[model samples]
Structures are given as C-alpha cells and as structure tokens.
Target: MKSRKRKIQAPVGRAAMLSLQINMLRDECCAVAAQLMKRKTLDEVELEDCARLDDALAEAYRILRHTVAKVTLARLRRKSRTRQQ
Candidate 1:
C-alpha cells in the first residue's frame, strides 16, 4: 500500500514565516486603524512614516499580548469548566 500523506514545503524558514505573518497582521491592523482615522482631525491622521511604523509596532504588541492573554484565559477556563462538569 502507498502512503496517503501529503507533505507541504515552506517557502521560508519557520522563524521567517512567523515574522512575515506577524508583520502582515500588523500592517492589516494599522490599515484598519488608519482608515478609521481618515475622517478625524488633522492631528488624528498619521503624517509620517515613522508615526505609522510606531502605530504598527504598537498594534503588533497589542495583538501578541491579547493572543497570549486569550489563550491563557481559555486554558484556565477549560480547566475550571472540566472540573465543574
């Protein structure tokens, strides 16, 4: 009998793929925030690339922080829920 498993190749290393995914997610978050600020005052708009980069960095941090928090919370909740059951 032949093996039925299919192997997938990564275009880049694991670290590189994680980095790129984080960067893309950060960019997407920043883009959404930027669009929300488009109708705001001049001071609310990102006028410099550095400022935009900063926002992206902050958003990335928030994403990571929230993801960790959520995972931890879910794990803890699962334990409690299982105990209750």
Candidate 2:
C-alpha cells in the first residue's frame, strides 16, 4: 500500500483571528439582546438582563478598539520599513 500525502493549511493571520473574535462577540451581543426583547414590556426585563447586554456591548467595543490599534500599528510598521528601504 502506498502512503498518500496530506496538504497542510496555512496559519491564520492576526487580522483574520481578530475578525473572528469580533464576529463571535457580535453574536453574543445579539443573543443577549434577543433575550431582553422576548419580554413584552420594558418593565418585564430584569436588571440582570440589562447589565448582561451592557457588559457584552462594552466587551465588543474593547475588542474593536484593540483590533483597530493592531491594524494601525501594522500599517505604521510597514510604512516605516518601506521608507527605510
């Protein structure tokens, strides 16, 4: 029997990884929002539910800022390298 070679996949880039994180965070926020929306009236919603949604939104914002900083840093580095060359 002959052995077959398997193709290896390339590693994910930093930006792609960050993008996935952002998407997951968005899904989480949507889920929390949906839970709150299930109630017929605003009074029906619990404080914990509101807090949960707020926390999720804060986390999403943090991740977005971090992603922006990383991309900006990468761009700056690339520009500096090109200038030096």
Candidate 3:
C-alpha cells in the first residue's frame, strides 16, 4: 500500500474571516462575563471593575454586530451580482 498525503487549505473568503472575528469576540465576551460573575460571587466586585467589564463586553458585542452586518451585505451583493449576470 502506498501512503497518501492530504492537503489542508486555509479558510478563504469574507465569510470565513467574519466567522473568525465573530468567534474571537464571542470568546472574549464569554471570558469577561465569567470574570465578572466570579467577582460578584466573591462579593469583591467594585463599580469600576464592573464598568470596565461592561465596556469591554459592549465593545465586543458592537464589533460582532458590525461583522454580521458586513457578512450580510456581502452575501446580498453577491446574490445581486449573480442575478444581474
């Protein structure tokens, strides 16, 4: 029997990039939320700490929303182009 090699291709396309960005932001949001929860449970959370986490979470969500919007627009543009052709 001969051994065969398999090739792995990197993700390519706007959708793939957007998916990667969304996954990263999701992970960041989850980590920040978990830290906030841990602090709350310990009753050591301060207003400043909460505010900082809130800002971080909000920013991540904002970026996620924008990335989704970009993906949607790209899909729509591609569809329209196909229709035009």
Candidate 4:
C-alpha cells in the first residue's frame, strides 16, 4: 500500500476576493486593538481594556459566524442530499 496526501485548493472568484478583504480587515482589527491599549491614565487604561475586550469578542463572533456559516451551509446541503437519496 502507498501513502497519499490530499492537497487543498485555493479559493477562487468571490471567495478569494473576500478572503483578501478579510485579511486586510483582520490587520486593521489588530491595529485597533494596539491603539486601544495605548491610553495613559490608570482609569483610562482599565476602561479601554474592558471596552476593547468587549468589542474584540463581538468582532470575533461576527467573523466566526461569517466564515463558519459557509461550512455549516455546506454540511447541511450535503446532509440534505444524503436524505434525498
């Protein structure tokens, strides 16, 4: 028996374009977090930390939903097809 590896293909068309945009957006998100952390006063830093974390978690959830929605949809479609058969 021979061992084999499967290769993953790069996304095409709208997916590729959207991936590029997402990459840029992710970088911007990092910059925003860094900026948020640069506040001076003790109170300001604590408030900024809390605010930044809340915003970051929300943003993460949104990004996860967007990307994972595609996977979930594909899985559902496959399951539907199986049921049809």
Estimated TM-score per prediction? 0.38, 0.46, 0.47, 0.42
In the predicted model 2, the residue pairs found to clash are: none
lDDT tens digits by residue: candidate 2, 6-75: 9763333655666667666767756666776776664444646656766775677687667767777787
How well does candidate 1 match the true structure in TM-score terms? 0.38
On TM-score, the stronger of 3 and 4 is 3
Q: Report the lDDT tens digits of candidate 1 across residue range 1-85.
A: 9989976643334434555577776677667667656865654444465466657776766666566666667768988999999
**Candidate 1 or 2, higher lDDT?**
2
Candidate with the greatest lDDT versus the true structure:
2
Each prediction's number of clashing residue pairs: 0, 0, 0, 0
Ranking by TM-score: 3, 2, 4, 1
Clashing pairs in 1: none
> What is the alpha-carbon lDDT of model 3 when measured against the actual structure?
0.64
lDDT of each: 0.63, 0.67, 0.64, 0.63
The per-residue C-alpha lDDT of model 2 at residue 71 equals 72
Per-residue lDDT value at 36 in model 1: 57
Candidate 4 per-residue lDDT, tens place, 1-85, comes to 9988887743434554565565566566566666656755345655566566657655765675577667767868988999999
Off by over 4 Å in 1: 1-47
Residue 23 error for model 3, in Å?
Answer: 16
Better of 1 and 3 by TM-score: 3
